[model samples]
Target: MKHTLYKHIQEGKTTGKKSFAVLVDPDKVNEATTEQLVSLALDAKVDYFFVGGSLVISHNLDECIRQIKVSCSVPVVIFPGSHSQISRYADAILYLSLISGRNPELLIGQHVISAPTIKKSGLEVMPTGYMVIDGGAPTTVSYISNTAPLPADKADIAMCTAMAGEMLGMKLIFMDAGSGAKNPVSIAMIEKVSSHIEVPLIVGGGITNPEKAYLNCRSGADIVVVGNAIEKDASLIRELSDAIHSVPVRV
Candidate 1:
């Protein structure tokens, strides 16, 4: 029932303080890289570490969270890809409902199977509306979820979906372009959605550089997440984090 992570995000939205989150996929990072990431995150003062991925084929999820916990004070949140991705080690979980797709399994089916376990795990649950925006490529998330992403250019659809999620009482709205995306979500879509929703807005995928991260925050994303890009070049962490945190909070 703790609202620590959610409260921080809500406050950030209210204050117009943009947050930068580093997405760490257990399948992609080893202990060494995770340690390296921890060091960078501490230096950059990252807001959160999102653990999990679209298709995690490894058994390192728990250990990944442990490693992060022992290394830094930054919050660790599970951006779970499936029911099996839950971990007691993390501080919080984004209990995502895939609102952008018609797949019943993603919207509610997965939640049912995971709810009991999540409750038992004692992780702070963040009811999130997860919308996957087309990232100009066929990414793993679309294939694994068995859902098509919202078209990149369709701002209206994205806006309405976010509005519906907010009305449904979801605590957060996450719009992702999917990892390894060729293009991030459009500014127009982000602006449209953020303007409509009262909850904090999260935008991720295809945000490879500080400039892109800065733009996303300026466009209205309260939190910007990056993963694949950091996986390839760990040095970008500071730049990306700095860029996101530097945006002047809009009044």
Candidate 2:
């Protein structure tokens, strides 16, 4: 089967609808908890399930993905933090390049190391430019990657970085504020980048409610991802899905 990430985004574009993605971090949840979360996400009509985290402390990634795939019908996309996170069972991988930081390791080094395996696995490779914005708190991604985030207040710099990624042939742009962020990316910054980028835009981190998700959609985020929030209250999945899907698309 083809990766559902591309299919879901295409479907959203065709229907003039926004997409909802639920992120699953293996390091954060155990087997039983992960299964329950996947079931809840599917029941809530989540458009896609993104697996992977900054730290895959557990070696059960493959098994985790396999179990989740069997339990849910939604597409599972690997939002890998490193090349080690790749698995054939996933429908696709967000071949990410961290654009906000100057660290060459995340920008291209990791991609080069994993390219052959990724190609051989036949997983859909969605080239995504990952941009991290300062979210007021230190996130695991920042600490582990050894990179600094772009200033949240600097829209111009963020725009430039996103444009560079686009020029580099990236298919998508993901602006993250980090998991459990103190504050999410500002609407002003999202608007600035979304207005300039033609590719799909995904925003995540620190979004705790449907209202924030709705704000992101209105500000032009093609997809809104919620992880910690849903981890706390799986029931919020339905509310978030409804909120994102209810946004009025521009005619």
Whole-model Cα lDDT of every candidate shown, in order: 0.94, 0.88
Best by TM-score: 1
Write the residue-wise lDDT of candidate 2 on 1-251 in tens digits.
Answer: 35556766856655568989999888777878887887778777888889999999888788888988898778888999888999999888999999998899999998899999998998988989999999999999999889999998999999999999999999899999999998999999999998898888899999999999999999989989889888788889999999998998757
In candidate 2, which residue ranges exceed 4 Å CA deviation?
1-4
Q: How many clashes show up per model?
A: 0, 0
User: Residue 193 lDDT in model 2?
Assistant: 96
lDDT of 1 by residue, 122-212 (tens): 9999999999999999999999999999999999999999999999999999999999999999999999999999999999999989999
Q: Which residue pairs does candidate 1 place in steric collision?
A: none
What's the C-alpha lDDT at position 191 in model 1? Answer: 95
